[model samples]
Target: MKSEAQTPQPNDLQPEKDEHKDSYNNIETPATDAENSNIIDITALENQMRNLSIGFNLKWLDVNVLPRKVVFEIQHDVQQKILKPLEDVVNTMQTVGLLSMEAQTIFKKMFAMFDGTETEYKFIECLKSADLYVVPREFVISNELRPGVIHNEQGMDNDPITGILMPIKFQLRKYLESPLVFDTILDNLTPSQDGYIRSLVDGTIWQQRRAKIDCNIVIPLNFFFDDFTTKDTVSPHASRTSILGIYYYIPCLPGYILAKLANILVAGYMLSEDRKEYENEDLFSNLVHTLIDLEVNGLTISYNGTDVTVHFMLGFITGDNLGVAGILDLVESARANFYCRMCKRNREQREKDATEYEQTFRTIDGYENDLLLNDVSNTGVHKNSVFNQIPSYHVVLNVYFDLMHDLWEGVCMYGLSHCLNYFIKVKKMFSLNELNCRKNVFVFGSTNSSNIPNDIKDTNIIKSKIKMTASEIKTLITFFPLIIGMLIPEDDPVWSYFCNLLKLCHILMLREIHPKLLDTLKSLVETHHTQYQQLFNDTLKPKHHNIIHYASFILRSGTPRHQWAMRGEGKHRDAKQYSRVNNNNTNLCKSLSIKAGYKFAQNVYNSSFVTPQIDLSNSKILDYPSDITFNSFVAEKIRLLNNSVHFIDSFIKQGSTFSHGTIFYVTYCNIINIFELDCILKDKSNNLILVCSSIMCRRFDEHLQSYEVYKTQVPKLISNIGCYETHTINIHSVNDKLYFRFCNFNVTDKVIESLFVN
Candidate 1:
C-alpha cells in the first residue's frame, strides 16, 4: 500500500484578504466604459453573491464557531459541499462549452463560496486527494500536446504522441488487499457454477502447477491492448486522435465481477499512429519491469488481518488480430505471406485448402532468428516485443486471439451475408423485403431483446459484409435459421453451410468445453470451411484460417469465450465517454486519468460488491412442499411458515437473472432434463428454493433449430437446481403448434457435465 502524506486542509469559513483578491481576479466580467467601471457598486455585488449562495441553502452559514473542532467540522462540511458540484463541473465541461482554463476559472468562483478562504489552486489540490494525480507527459521532441488537435508550428520533429502511465504496482496491491475482490477470488478457486469453469486459474496448466507460484498467494493477471478511435470516423481528426489503450484484470474473479468496468484497471494510453515500433515498446517497458520485480520479490499485503506475499504472472494477452500482431512484433498486414503470429501459412496455401505440407508454428527460437535476419518478409516476425521479457511468458504462446473479432465480426458476418445473398439473391427462396419484414416483427426472447440486430440494408447484403456490431451479428446468426428455415430445404448446401457455421460458434462459446469437444470443434471448423468453399467457390479469409488454432489455444488456456476482448474492449468506452464529456483534447489522456482515479477512489471507499436485492415481505408465505425432502436438501433445516416458501417475481444470483417461464437445464437419472422457473421460494435462512415445472424434449425440430419440447403432466417439485445458469428460448405458437428455439444450441451438453445439475 502506498502511504498518503497528510497535508493541512484549508479552513473554508475564514477568508484571507490576499487569497480573496486573487480569486476575484479569476472571475470574468464584461468590460464597461471607464465611468461605469470606476463607480462603486459594493452593495449590488454583495447582493448578487448572496443570491448565488442561496442555491446551497446552507443553514450553518450564520453559525459562529467557538471551538477549534467545530471550525474544523465546518471546513470539512464546506469541502463536502464543493466535491459533488465540482465533479459535475469537471465531467460536464464539454456539454457546457468550456475549455480547461475556463473551467478552472469557474472552479475559482465555486471556491469563493467558502468566503474566498482558498483559491483555485487549493481546490485543485483537494481534487488531487491522496488517491492519484495524473499529469500529461510529452513523448515527442516537439513537445506538442496530443497528436490530433494540435500541430507543431515551429517546424520541430512531427512525431507527436502524448502518453499517460498509471501506477500499476499501487493498483495491483490495492486489488490484493481489497476484501471484496480477494474474498471472491479465494471463494472461486474452482468453478463457482457447475459447468462454467472458464477462468484462467481453472486451466489444466494452472491446475497442475506447471507455472511457478513461489509466494504465499498467487494472482492470475490477464493483460489487454487495443487501438480505438476517440473521435467519430467521419471526422477528419478521427485517425489522428486514435489511442492505444492498455488494460488489465484478474482472471481469478468470477465472470460477473470481471465483466464490471470497476474491476478492469487502466494501465496507460498513447496515440497509436505516427509512432515507431520501439516507441511502443518503450511505453510498455515500465509495465514489463514492474511485473518482473513483483514476480521476483512478491508484494506482501495485509489480508484479513494477516500479511501474505502475493505474486502474479501474465496469464495471457488478448486483443484483435491487428492488436495481437503489434504486441508480438509480427508483420501486422493480414495480406502478408506469413500474416499469422501463431503459425506460418501463406495466402496461397490457405486458398488451395492445402494440408499436406507440415505445419510450422512460431517459437521463441524462431522469433530470435527472425529478428536477426535483415529481410524478414518470409517470416512474420517484425521485432522483439517487450512482453517476452516476462519470466515464463512468451508472446508466441501466451498471446491469444479474440473470439469476438475473429468469429462474430469476421466469420459470422461473412458466412451469414453470403448465405443470405444466396438464399434471397441467387436461389430466390425468399425476397429481401419479406425477410426484413419478418425480422422487424419477430418477437425475441427476454434474454436477446437487448441485442437484436439492425435491419439488413441492401448495401450490406450486396457487399457480403453484414454491417453490424459483434453482438448483433451473434444474435442474428443464432436466430437466422429460425427466421427463414421454413422456406429453405434441409439438404440445401448453402443452408447446411450456414447451420454448420452456427454450430461452430456455439461450441466455441461453451464455458466448459469438454476435452472430447475439442475434436468436435476442430471438425466443425474444417467442415464449415469446406462447405463454404464448395457452396460459394470463394477462398476463406484470414479469420477462417486463424480459427484453425482455437481448439489448441483453448487447451493451453481455458475456453476462448473467457479470454476474448469483449469485456476489455468495453473498457475503452469509459475513455470515449469521458472524451465526449470533458472534450479536453489538448490534455485528453491526463483529464481521463484524473477522472478515472476519482472513480476508482470512490470504488475503493465504498463496498465494491453489489448485494442481491430480494424483498418478499409483502408476499404470502406457503408451507414446505410435501414431496420434496426439505430437511435432506438443506444443510440446517428450520421450522415452516417462518421457514417457508416466499414467491418472488424474479431471482438474481451472480449476474444471471431468473424469472417465471425462464428455461434452464439440470441432470436427473443420469440424463439431461429441462425445467422452467414456476416460482421463487426462500427458506428461513434466506436460501432460495427453485420450484420448477418439468418439461420433456420430444425431438429436435430441424426447421426451427430447437428442441421440440412440451410441458410435463405435472409440475415437479425439484430442489438443488435453483438459480443455475439459464439458456434463452423464444416460445412460439404457430398454427396451434408450440415450438421453442434455443438461443444457443450447445446448452444440452453443458448441462450434462455441470455438477450443480441434480
Candidate 2:
C-alpha cells in the first residue's frame, strides 16, 4: 500500500489573468485622463494623500497547510454487492449482440464487502445513462396547479439499481498465477461418473455447493509518478498549501497509452519531468510483462480441454473531465487549435463560418482530411505503426463524450441555470423568497419539500456570491423542462427552446436512435446557436454563454449518455460524502477505494459460476391466492375500454399520475405477454397487476413503481423511453403512482413517430 505522497500531480498552466491582462489597453477613465494630461495631479495627489492611519493590507491570503496523506490500503474485503444499474446495462447488452455464447457474461458470484449504510442508487429509470440520483417528486413545484406535480401515487419509490461486492484480489491473483484452485473447482463441478460416484459413495457433502477461503488477497499496485507533471505554488485544499501538482497530489489515471501505466504510477514519475522510457516500454506493455512473469496472464488457463482466452480487447481510450492532460496518450482538449477528434473543426473561425458550421457534423471529405492531416492525432490511435502493431486497439473510433458532465453539466445545466436565473430573478417569474417564507411558516404543509434545502435563506434575501453547484443545476435541468408549463407561458421562447433541448436529449439518448436522429440533432444545435443566442444575449444576459458550442461534440460523437466517466463521477459522489467523516484527512483514498472497488466489482465477477438456481428439493414454491377477479377493476377508470391484452398491439397506455401536466409515457407500447383474464391484488399493497410469475406478482402492492419495468421488450418503434428488457413483470407501484412524467403519443407525435416507418 502506498500513500498519496508517492503519487505525483500535474499543475495548471498560465492563469487567465497572466495570459489576458497585457492584451487590454489603458481605459480612458477620468483618473486615466487626468493622469495622462499630467496637469493638476502631482501636487494635488500628494496633498490628497495626507490621510490618517487607514491602511488596507490587500495581499492574496496564503494559508500554509500539509497535503492530505494520499495512500492505498488493500481492504481485507472479499465480499461485494450487486449494482442494479450495471445489471440493467448487462441485461440490455445481452439482449443486444454484445454478449453471445462465445463471449458470455461472467462474474455472477457473490462476495460480501460492507455492512449497512444506504448503498442503493436510484436510476433515471428510462432512456440510457448511468447518471444516478434518488430525487423525490415533492421537490417539483408549480402554481395554478396542485403541488408535488410529478408525484404519482403509482410511481416507483426508492427504485434501486443493484451493486456488487469487491472480489478477493488475493484469490484472483492466486488463481490467475496458477490453475490449481480453478482447475479443482471446475473439475469437481465437471460432470463425470467418477466425481458423481465419489459424491454419492465417499461423501453426500459433495452434492452441496461450497466456497473455499479463496486466498488472502494481496494486490500489487503500480504507483508511478510521471515527470511531465505540473505543480502550483499554493493550494488551499492541501493541508500545507505549498507547491502541489495540477493533480493536487492525486495520481493521474488517464495517461497510459499503454498500461502497466509505463505504469508511471507503478514507477513513480512526475509530470514535471521530461519524457523518458523506464524500460523502453509503455505502461500497458510493462503491465503485460509483469503479469506474464507473475504467471497469471490468463493466456494459459485451460478448461474442458480448451484454453480460455482472457485477453481484454483494447477499445479506444476516452477523455474525461476537462481533458487538459489526458490519462491515455491520445486525449487532448477538444477546444485546442486542432479542436475536434472526429472532424476538421480545427479550421480557422472564418472557415468554420463558411461551411454552414462544418464543426458540428462531419462530412466525408472533412473526415478524410482530418484523417490525413492529424493522422488521428486526437486519440493517437492511427499514428504510424500503432494500429498495425496492435490490431485490437482501433484509433479515432469509439471516442465518447460524457453526458452527465460534458453535456448536462457543460451545456444543459451551464446554459439552463442562466436561463432559470433570468426568468426567476430577473423576470420575477418564480419567487425564492416566497418559497423560503412559506417553509418557515409551516414545516409539514404543502409548501415544504424534502427535496428543498432546509437552510436555504432565499438568495433574494441576502447579497450572495456563491453560484449554484452542479448538483443543484442538474436537479433543475433533469425535471424542470417537462414541468415548466405551469411556471411559464406556453408561448414563451425560453420554454420552446428548452423543450427543443429536451427533445434533442431524447433523440440522442433513446434506446435505438431514431433514423432522423442526426438530422434532428443538427437542427436543434443550429437553432440554439443562431436563434436562441440572440434571445439570451439580447434579453437574458446569459451566464452560461458558451454552452451552444458543446452541442457540436454531441452531434458528432453520438450519445455520450452511456459513457462511464459521468457514472464514475456519480459513484464518486457517494465516496466523497463518506470521506468527510473526519477532519484528520486520513485515508481519503482508502475510503474512496472501498466505495469504488465495490462499484467496479459489482460489474465484474466470476463468470465460472452462474446465479445459483434455487434448489427445488430443499424449498417449495408458494402460490398466493388472488383477491380480485379481472372483472373487479373499474374498466373505464383504468382505461381498459379499447385496450387489448394482445402481445402484438401498438398504442397508447400512459401512467396514472402527473408531474406538472406531463404524464409517464407507457406509449409506443407493444405488448409481449397476455395471461388468461386475471388481476391479483397484492398483500399489504393493493396494486392490481396482470398475473405472471408468483414471484413477480407478489410484489404489486407497492408504491412509486414504474409500469415500464414490467413491460417486455418490443420493437423500438413501439416503445423507446424508459424501457428495460425482462422476461417477467416487476411492477413496484400501484396504478396511481404511474404518473405522467412525460408526454404521450397524442402530445409528442412528431418526436416518437420518428422511431417508426411511415
lDDT of each: 0.65, 0.31
* Per-residue lDDT value at 8 in model 2: 50
TM-score: model 2 vs. ground truth: 0.42
Query: Per-residue lDDT tens digits of candidate 2, residues 1-758?
Result: 77666655565233344322432353333333333335444444332221100000000000012111211111111122234445455567767866542222231111111221112221112101211111211111112223342455543344221111122222233233332334433333322342211111112211121112122221222111112211123434443111101111001111111111111111111111112222112323433343333323333444556655332222223334333123333334444544444443443441223123444544434444544776554322222222213332223333344454555555564456546565666777777665345334432312113333343344523332224444544444434532333456667777667766655455444422332444565676556554445655532111122233334433333233322243233322333343444232332333233333323222222221121121112222223333432223333322442232222111111211111112123323321221122222122221123232111111221111111223322212222222322221112222333222221112222233432222
TM-score of structure candidate 1: 0.75
Q: For model 1, which pairs clash? A: none
Q: In model 1, which regions exceed 4 Å deviation?
A: 1-161, 189-197, 202-210, 232-240, 274-278, 354-359, 609-645, 666-672, 718-724, 727-736, 743-758
Per residue, candidate 1 scores C-alpha lDDT tens digits across 515-630 of 67777788888898788788888898888887887777776677878778899988888777656555556656666665555455445544463333333434455444454433
